[model samples]
Target: MEEADSCRRAALEAVADVEPPRLHEYLDSILDRASMVPAVLTLESAAAMRTEGRVLEDADEPHRDGESEPDRNRTQAVSSDRDPARITTHAAGVQLIYEGLRLTRSLAHDEPWTATDAEASDADLGILAADILVARGFYLLARTDAADKAVRTVQSFGRDQTRREDLESGAETSAGTAVGIDGGDPASTDANLERDVLELAVRTGAVAVGETPSPRLHAVVAEFAADVGTSFPPVADCLTDLHARARELSLEDSTTDRATSATDP
Candidate 1:
């Protein structure tokens, strides 16, 4: 349990420090390190359940509750051997979920737009943060109970749709009504959106950072977005847009890789 807690803390800190393109890399590293605890705990739990089943079957033969004390003791002995690891996994899972929450909060902590209105603000940061939180919640849900709870909490918070207020505020900010506008280009804005979504997807353990929509992934995103009263159409549209952008970026990356390789020779 202590080890798990330590892993969670370390993972959270690492993610907090990660920059845009590198966030997913940090998450992958942390998850790889922490993966062993749950795997071991799952095996131990399965073994205990099997043993408990046999003991229950034997106890049903002829004994009343009080008379099965000896059998109960034996069953407990076996159970005890499994308890520490199970506890450790549960604790670790909880800690990881908490870390996910912390990450989300940190991302949402500020305004989404920069003072210049050209880049992502602290609010936009929160949306990106929430995206990662939702994805991580899905990944961890398969391994831990705490992850399910985290998913529920995030679901309660609503989806990733751009609210009217947000759009209006953003437009105003970019137009220089708030602070002076930074005059960032459409390409930069699009790139930022793509980068943020891809970062979230990778952190959540999607197979690749480029375009490719798994139904399960879409379902997860839909659930998260449902809170904002976003219908499936817009959600689908957003996802398609992200995927298209990711594919374009991937092609660019591939071209760059080939060029670099060619140049090296």
Candidate 2:
């Protein structure tokens, strides 16, 4: 938990320089829980990569010897580098916020899976709130020059969902069967959803910065995304350690720690 807080604070410090001030309040509202592990993890990973060539040295740090500026001046930023990793980190966080809010509204109603229930007056406020979140997500993506990747991600999700619906329309639902265990399998599991969103955000950030990520970076995002999607499952008892492992992976060239990975259902 403490590590997560440190990451959150560090990410906030970096993001504040590029994004609008008021937008941060919205991020705070969305990431107001321990369950937002995905955004936190993604933010930490990208922030580490973003600082690879540069120094953190945010405005809040104390001045060196022979400096004359007052403490008030310390609140200023250091550089205006539009780092790709940092940009995608912010975009991913926005996407997670949108998904979390939308999922909450959709699952809050009596018929949790019913599409119509979430649009009713009872859930109007939540639905509207989710709408704003998605808008904010698009805004951030475009601001970072990841508009194309963001568009592709959304289009992919739509196609996947439509295909799933089409499959279900012609499939049979017998006793004791889940949605994807039967003939409707489209590899749409909970973990994949988390991985897809995480990869999309990370890749979007990387793409915006005109970076061609190595296979290790892609693996890192997938592994971390699984952790976020499963709510830090297998190693939930040792989240601080898990975070440490993830940080080490982000800052160096290292293989994944499969021990912390979530189990398949």
Tell me the tens digit of each residue's lDDT in model 2 across 45-101: 454345244344555456777776663353232122244345434644445443643
> Which regions of candidate 2 are displaced past 4 Å?
1-34, 50-78, 81-119, 171-191, 204-212, 226-242, 250-265
* Model 2 lDDT-worst window of ten: 74-83
Candidate 2, residue 65: lDDT = 77
Candidate 1 residues 140-222, lDDT tens each?
33443234444554443333222223444577456554321213332222222222332233222221111233343344333
Model 2 lDDT at residue 35: 50
Report residue 39 deviation for candidate 1 (angstroms): 17
What lDDT would candidate 2 get against the real structure?
0.48
Residue 128 CA displacement from its true place in model 1, Å: 4.7
Residue 36: error of model 2 in Å?
2.3
Question: Clashing pairs in model 1?
Answer: 111-121, 111-122, 111-123, 112-121, 112-122, 112-123, 112-124, 113-121, 159-225
Clashes of each: 9, 0
